[model samples]
Target: MRDDNASPDEPGTSTDRSGLSRRSFLTAAAALGLLPAGGRAFAEDKLLTFEKPRAFSFDLLADQARRMAMQPYIETKSRDPKVLDQIDFDAHWKIKYRPEATLEVADGSAPVRLFHLGRYFQLPVGIHVVDGDKSRELRYDPVVFEMPEDSPARKLPKDIGYAGLRVMAPDQKTDWLAFLGAAYFRSAGELNQYGLSARALAIDVAMPTPEEFPRFTDYYLERSTTPGHELVITCLIDSPRMTGVFRMDVGKHGPVVMDIDSRFFARDKIDRVGLAPLTSMFWFSETDRPDRIDWRPEVHDSDGLALWTGSNERIWRPLNNPPMVRTSSFADRGPKGFGLLQRDRSFANYQDDGVFYEKRPTVWIEPKGDWGAGEVQLVEIPTDDEIHDNIVVYWVSEKPVGRGDEIPLSYRLTWSKDEPHPAEVSTVTATRIGRGGIPGQPRPKGVMKFAIDFDGGYVAKLDRDAKGVEAVVNASRGELSNIECYSVKIGTAWRMTFDIKADDPEPVDLRAYLKSGDQTLTETWLYQFLPEPDSAA
Candidate 1:
């Protein structure tokens, strides 16, 4: 399975805010009288005002995004090292936002909360509130958020800015939306356990050059009259390479969704421009597991990369935790949609009660306009555990992005289990891997077996002796044998079974999808088989 946890600052140093150190803040908050006493609430105002915007417009934000792309990049640093020094993981956790301090905004007037800076997040960000056509910035004060008497956050200075912002639902007890770090933003998804994150844009990810992370330097929040729909947020993105303005429309129905529209201004030349970029973790699965030592059967935030190309083909590519960084791109005229999906939504698969992996939501992105010619790219990195994120997928455009160039992007982000695009044909439901050979005969050396199940439409019509139904199997460096196609008697689906005998350790590229004569019955299922220890030639 994949990993969780936001990218905090570097580990070890007490100054780094990225969720590493713990003990410093407690000692300091006690000396400064910032600690909450015996459940007593700290007296602090939840709402305050910053600089007010005369007018609010999406175009204006886009213009800003475009304009920033033309200038040199500026890096934001902590102003008060003493306060930033005191704020660590434990200190940030201790400085809780007062329930009464919640700023009532949209969603029929619900309070929105703010996240304070800590060791994991030391840089300051501007927070603002928008009401109707008016917008104002919020002041950061130590008294605004109530904390424990011994809490270290109280020792921090008043002007230390917030790391990010979060929006609460109708009830102020829980938050459903959070814009925490960088361009990293996410809703609780459908399952409420924040799974994958959608970024504003991806620049040079998995590139040989150092990756550049753009930050939302400032934000403007405003309420809308639409019921069920809460506030509209306008974010100002700044980086060394580009600047962008984003308007996010957030709401809740069956699940939370963010309708994002933005314009980007490039300040420097970019080798790779990623649209609708998604970050996820894929640690281990049945196919990738070296040894089944873990108690939990399967582990991963997402199982596959689901893509609906402009060619009207739905493709499912399962993720892998490769030995090194691997990137794959599928060229298309205009991608209909794509996303990193958590397809296996069964508690039985992940047995983790504390953090229910099954309930994690799958995010789908639908481009609003003609994306032109671009390829959806998938990047996978090797990870030993579920702590580091290793999976990334995004749409890359063919056109070059240079300084002063303005790019407009709009997309609908869906946080749900099932994708909106309905498939007429049944899809690959499960993939299982095991050692080849029967119990009676000696097992063939360097042989492996794969069992794949297709659960839906065309498969239900397949007969045990179907005339046209056939399994097409291909390998990169191996001989295929014992290939068989059969209709499972218990279910209304067909099964494609195959075994591979490889002479070398090179990975075998396997492609299989249901086909009847010249007609294609199912989406292509792509898998890569890694050679065993003793199989290397």
Candidate 2:
């Protein structure tokens, strides 16, 4: 993982790239104020310098991406890696942008701040401000940044360039959104706590071959003219395998929302192209509490993947921390939307009050146009600690992508405490796993119990002692037993508990839902159970 200098004292964590750790991403700009007390205005010295203006447009950027795809890829290199490498976490934080030097777009509609290049982010990304049909590149100079007396960043060259950028709040102490290493970006959503990261695109993810991380090489920031929209961010992303242009219309009304338009040009055949990908952390929740060694009862940014299929079926798949890397694909056509949700907002679930996991935002992906024939893919990588981001979910179109292909996908991402649209059917509240057989009897070996809860919608109004409730269940490779459905003694929610004897060493895919006679009472619950030898069954 690669992230540099993101302080642990910060509110949210960022997923690391090659040189950075997962916790190093967001802390740089999430809550820290760049300026020291009473830092004077640098406007008198023309702090925000710029190069000559050049005509720019999303269409032009997309066309350029297509042309770039036709030619061999040229990678960007750091001007002085040795010096940058010395700018580690502490030193990098010392070099902060001066508040007075912040760039104001369209007469201060949005304020933009620059990030200094550091060890993890050695290669510089161009920063530009767009006005009308023309855009001007911001000049990088030591004058804009405040460095300590002996900061390592002082050794860098004058034109070493910027690493990334963030959109600042009016207070300037905290940032609402930030674009950092690789193609990753994160927004401090309605809760003002950063948890997950969203990427422009993902290539060859979870494949046998190593994954490729494309970089956003340049950015064009502009003020949004729309009433609700605050900023317009356009970027040019490049890699050996693909090139693309993404335009994001971002607004911070309650929940942070970004309306994104991505145009990609494939330079080579892609086995899997993940569109609108979201990267998160799911270490151990109530579902895997028995496997956890940490003191916290639960720890995760998201607990489940909520999907609305093209066939009008709503599914809730609880996230798992598998024994190995697990990739689950749900096939559909003209899909509606999908998102990773953090339903449990109770602070007691995660006792570590430092990071406030309870306030982490749930990000939902909403497709703009018809995304025909695709699979919502969830790739979970095993992690023992919360420092690593191990969960990634995205929409991958079934259509094979080859060189010389031009594709355009548009979607909106909403980061909040709940989904943009709540489920019409009762939604899953919690999932727990433990011993399979009865408590007083000898527990069956190779068997595991699954306890799932669902509340709201049609199920909420039903009687707690309803006699005809049924659990529609299915297992890919297991003998299911102890199937039962009843009302919980705690809340208005209904509970569905069952046990499956999965002898196979491989994972068992299971599905169940609460139903009354012929009518479905809750959204379908899907899970993958990994068997553990010599454990309670």
What's each prediction's TM-score? 0.88, 0.93
Top candidate when judged by TM-score against the true structure? 2
What are the per-residue Cα lDDT tens digits for candidate 1 across 492-515?
Answer: 878888888888876678888878
Off by over 4 Å in 2: 1-13, 17-45, 106-109, 535-537
What 10-residue stretch in candidate 1 is worst by lDDT? 25-34
Q: lDDT of candidate 1?
A: 0.69
- What is candidate 2's local distance difference test score? 0.79
For every candidate, C-alpha RMSD to the true structure in Å? 6.0, 3.6
